[model samples]
Target: MDATSRHSKILDLLNSQERVEVEDLAARFGVSLQTIRTDLRDLSARGVLSRVHGGAVRVSSAANRAYADRRKQNATAKQTMAALLAEFIPDNCSLAINIGTSTEQAARSLENHRGLTVLSNNINIINLMMGGEAKELILVGGTVRQSDGAIIGEDAV
Candidate 1:
């Protein structure tokens, strides 16, 4: 397969699997570990995935936020940050907000927007966005984390 196709496939796998090993991809794709690493590097550079010690993690704008505990620990700060960030987003735009407490706060901050499409993985965020004026809201499916209020696993794509 071409590099793009291969990268897409890799992303699909990473989205589905919590983690993937370099050797496994090399063996399954009949490529050398070096080639797999190169592909992973290119994909990571594009913000498609994050290179971890064992594998990669899918990258979403919401992925930039802190965990629920950290977010809740400073709810005021998160709310303030969300309010500030919300100012930069133009109306009637598509945005994929990841599943995290801070991102949830950000989503809540957008409640006044008239039209915005939000793709998310957090059920909590989705619940909040449902009450917003956004034109569209999409929840990426996968394993759900009740504690963190985010989704992770095979169905996230």
Candidate 2:
């Protein structure tokens, strides 16, 4: 298989198995150890995986992938949960939303709610609620996490 196809398969394996050793990848792909190492390096550089001493693991935990990947997973369920939560949030109330794909979805669902003061550390949520019906949108100041656009740090406290 071509390098692109091989890399894709490696990602698939990593997604399902969490981690893959260099020797195992080489054997599975019928490639040399050097080639497998190169693939791991490339994936790690792209922030798709984390290279370890003998193998590579998915960049994020088993329950969580990268932000973009997490956004695609359980999307329908997130929207449903967002809708349910939005219902409980009455108008003219203040809320602090945290970082996470589900929270971002919930913020989207709250776009039409009038007279809300939404405070958040998630840049995605702040952007989503901007110019909406909320009475105020407060973005907590802190260092922005490049991987997930989440504002986190001591300053955010």
Candidate 3:
């Protein structure tokens, strides 16, 4: 397969197994060891995985996936949860939305709701609710996380 498709499959394998050996990948894909090494290096560069002695492992637990990547993963489930959350919010009320992909989905689901006020620390949520039916959108300011537009730090608390 082509490089992009191969990379996707490698990511899938990593997701399921949490790690992959270079030899196994080369044998499975009918490619050379160098090819698999290169694939691992590329994926590592993209922050998708970490290259080890004989293979690669998923990135560390301390680091979150890229915002776009996190948003795409379990997207359907997030949407469903957002829809359910929207059903519970009544009109002319207020809400405190947090940062993260799920909260973004929840904000999107609230676009049609009227007479509600939204309190959020996520810049994306504020942008989404702008000019909508919500009566007011209050952005709790602090340090904005460059990775996910999350306003955090002690000031936000």
lDDT of 3 by residue, 1-157 (tens): 8889889999999888978999999999999999999999999999989999999998864345788888888899999999999999988898999988889999999889998888999999999888867478899979999999999999899
**Ranking 1 against 2 by TM-score, winner:** 2
Tens-digit per-residue lDDT, 1-157, candidate 1: 6778878889889768766678888888888888888888898888878887756777755444456446656789889999998999889999999866778889888989878988888888888878646468788878887667778888886
Report the lDDT tens digits of candidate 2 across residue range 2-92: 8899999998998689689999989998999999999999988888889999899887653345689989888999999999999999999
| Candidate 2 regions with alpha-carbon error over 4 angstroms | 1-64
lDDT of 3 at 47: 90
What lDDT does each candidate get?
A: 0.80, 0.89, 0.90
lDDT of 2 at 71: 93
The prediction achieving the highest TM-score against the true structure is: 2
lDDT of 2: 0.89
